[model samples]
Target: MKTTIEKFAGDTEGVSYELTVFRFKGTSKTAPSAYIQAALHAGELPGVVAIHALMPKLRAAEAEGRILGDITIVPAANPVGRAQYVFGELEGRFHLGTRTNFNRDFPLLDRPDKAALPPPPRNATVDVHLKRLLVGLSVGHDIVLDLHCDDEGVPYLYVPAQLWPAMQDCAAAMGVEAVILWDGESGAAFEEAAIHPWLQLPAEKAPLEGRVVTTVEFRGLADVYDRYARTDAEGIYRLLATRGVIGDAKAARPRKFSGVAAPIDRVELISMPRAGAILFHVEPGRSVRKGARLATIVHTPGEPDGSIDILAPQAGYVLTRVSKRSGRAGDDIIKLIGEARSARPKAGALED
Candidate 1:
């Protein structure tokens, strides 16, 4: 087990932030390697805890010489977001200075030429530097897992369309409740940026068989607990074993996963019509019929007949909901995973 700290120049003078990486070296150079990161959105702590639980097992494997390939773990991927706080509220999703999402607009390198790359600004923000450093570390790995969590939701995965059935084992190992496949350039997210170059290469020349990348959402914010973390960690270990990164003790175990996988566009975002207090009628992972009452908004709390009901537009599973009880008009209150629904925008970005 080896630890390395990568320092990135901060936005302000004399300030800096560091990313800690844990590496477990393997014997074979051609063996599959993996990069796992947690808390890119610092407020999402479930992945952080889960990674903590995963480390001990990895250490045990290291001692037993069961590790077949290199493994890298970044327990906390965003120091900037982790430190962001205003008036007692943690603002970790987007940069406060630039109002840009921390996960969006990452640098994409399709070729090895430096001339083809866009010139950096004379004074880039801290977020840009952070993105560059993070992407640089993950670019060559055979497998990349960016662990995150939704505002409030069940365990789900965001995968690229090209990696579908191949990633089913990973999804099954994680025990994810849902998988959403997307393709093309959406918003230059980290996963896309890291995997795009290889995907762009000619099929005959590219080593497509060795690459696997996906973003794992480890349920909701409030779902952070020891039991969940341990379960998630064990699932990740099983995934590693199944992938041949570790020995095949847990890998030989039968699959117990029972989740639905669908295209990203098929997952509908049910938004609120008016601002009000929300009362949810359904929980995450629950099945719902089309036109079933999903939630109710008290738009005018003191007035008679002040409530408005939000119904499911299609028959599917309730994958997630907004974390806050109060929301404004047009706010996405619920997310449904339905079959054969009209596709949303095909751009590769995730819904915020």
Candidate 2:
């Protein structure tokens, strides 16, 4: 077990942030390696707690000489977002200086023409530097898991389309309720950036035979309890064991999984029409039919018949909802997993 602090060039004068990485070295060089990170959006804390709970187990495995593969854990992946605050509230989803999402626009080397790859930009922002450092550490790993959480939702996973079938066991081990599969590049997200380069080559030329990468959404932001953390940690442990990264008796045993994997485009995103107080009629993991009233928005509560009902566009299960009851127009309010009904909006990224 080893710990190292990697420093990033600071955004402001006389200020710099450090990323702490925990490494558990394996004896064999041929063994698979894994990179697990949490809190890329620093406000998402379930992954942070889960990482904390996961550490003790990893330490125990190290002591027992059960570790087969190198494992790297970054409990807090974004120091810049962690320090961002407006008034008394913590703002960690996007950089305050640039308003860019913490998870999007990663530096990727996967180009159509190998020789056409652009050189690294000079005087890059702190976020770009952070992305470069994180990507540098994670590329070439056999498995990469970016732990995150939704505003208010059940446990779910966003897996690349190519990796979905291969990751069913991992999804089972993680006890996620749903798995969203995405193909093509929405944006150069961390997980996509880490795996896309290898995917660009022909099957015969690509070296991504055993690679697995996915974003594991732990749950809602408010679900930071120790019990949940422990459960999530154990799930991760089971996955590592199942992947042969660590030896465990239960590794060979069959595990039951309850989640269903669906295409990302099929997932319905219910956005707010007008800014108002929202009253939700459904919760996460509930099934609904087309035209079902999911929520009601009161644009003018004091006026008679001022409320507008939001209906489900398609039949599916409720996956998540916004944490805030009040939202502005066009805000993301709810998400549902269903058959493809309407085309996705013209957006650079998936999430708001």
Candidate 3:
């Protein structure tokens, strides 16, 4: 296994973004290759552990000559977001000045205009150019696994529906039963852009023909040295083996909630509209009826405090809730999973 760090774009007096590569060579060109990246949002640390554990296995596979194809691992993919800090707290999710989510704004090529290309020839200009860049770096193989984790909860995989069965086989090897399908509506998430959206394009537009490209999401913020982290790492290695990049995957015991799942149809981000002290009336994961008491917001500045009771606007399952006691206006208090409904102009405002 040979590791090299190359500067792709930004590197200045104080800022640098380097692409870290771990290459493991296979004897035949027929073998499949794998790519893995982590820490796009630096605060999500499980993926960092997942990639770190994958490295030693890659090295072992290389030494044993068990490698079936080339493998590339990038443990830290975003240096800019990873280095951001605010008031001693690591603020790695957004760009400091712009406040833009670093994971958003992925670039994509426009579909070719019919006039530009005749029937016999397809418009492969844009994606071809884009693929040329990624392929040139790892010219020998096929497959890319962009790993990630949420801020607070369970593990899941975002597999593009187009690449089903093939990628499904790959996912199943990790005993991953649930997949959060990216049906083209999860706006601008890096994995959605790189893996799922590419799968949606027509054959002429897609760059990968038969390769498996998908992402794995481990459970949310928790102990780095916890058993869950170790379990997640092992699952990744098993996935590598099933892809023919390594030897047999270690046996793993599936968790309680191990199974395929669909992404929530709607995300009702409940937040307070006024500065107040929060008091919860319901726990997370509870199904609440419309108009039921959900929580209470109180203005507790003086001895005699005034409070406003908050109620659920619709029936839904509470996916998450804020634990903080105090909240400012517009701070997210909870996120409810709800039934599909038409888009409203001020949809989010209703929740707040």
The whole-model lDDT of each prediction reads 0.84, 0.85, 0.59
* Candidate 1 CA-lDDT value: 0.84
Prediction 2 global C-alpha lDDT: 0.85
User: On residues 1-352, what C-alpha lDDT tens digit does candidate 1 reach at each position?
Assistant: 9999998878889989999999999766667888899998889999999999999999998898888889989999999998899999999999998988988888888852334356667878999888877777777777889999997899998888888877777888888888888877769888788678777678777666556788889999988999999999988888888777877675646575468888877778888999999999999989998889999999999899999999887788989998899999988888888765744533456464
TM-score of 1: 0.94
RMSD of each: 2.1, 2.6, 7.0
Clashing pairs in 3: 177-259, 177-260, 178-259, 178-260
Task: Output the better candidate (1/3) by TM-score.
Answer: 1
lDDT of 3 by residue, 1-352 (tens): 7778765432235544555766777755766677777766667778888767667766776778777777777777666666678888887766665565655544332321213222222433222222223333432235666666654444556666566645655666555535644455344455444553344457775555456666666655553654665676677777667666665544322223335444434555677867889888876557788778878888765546577777776776665565477899888777555544313212211221
Which has the greatest TM-score? 1
Pairs with backbone N, CA or C atoms under 3 Å apart (clashes), candidate 2: none
Instruction: For each candidate, give its TM-score against the true structure.
Output: 0.94, 0.94, 0.70
Q: Per-residue error at 320 for model 3, in Å?
A: 4.2
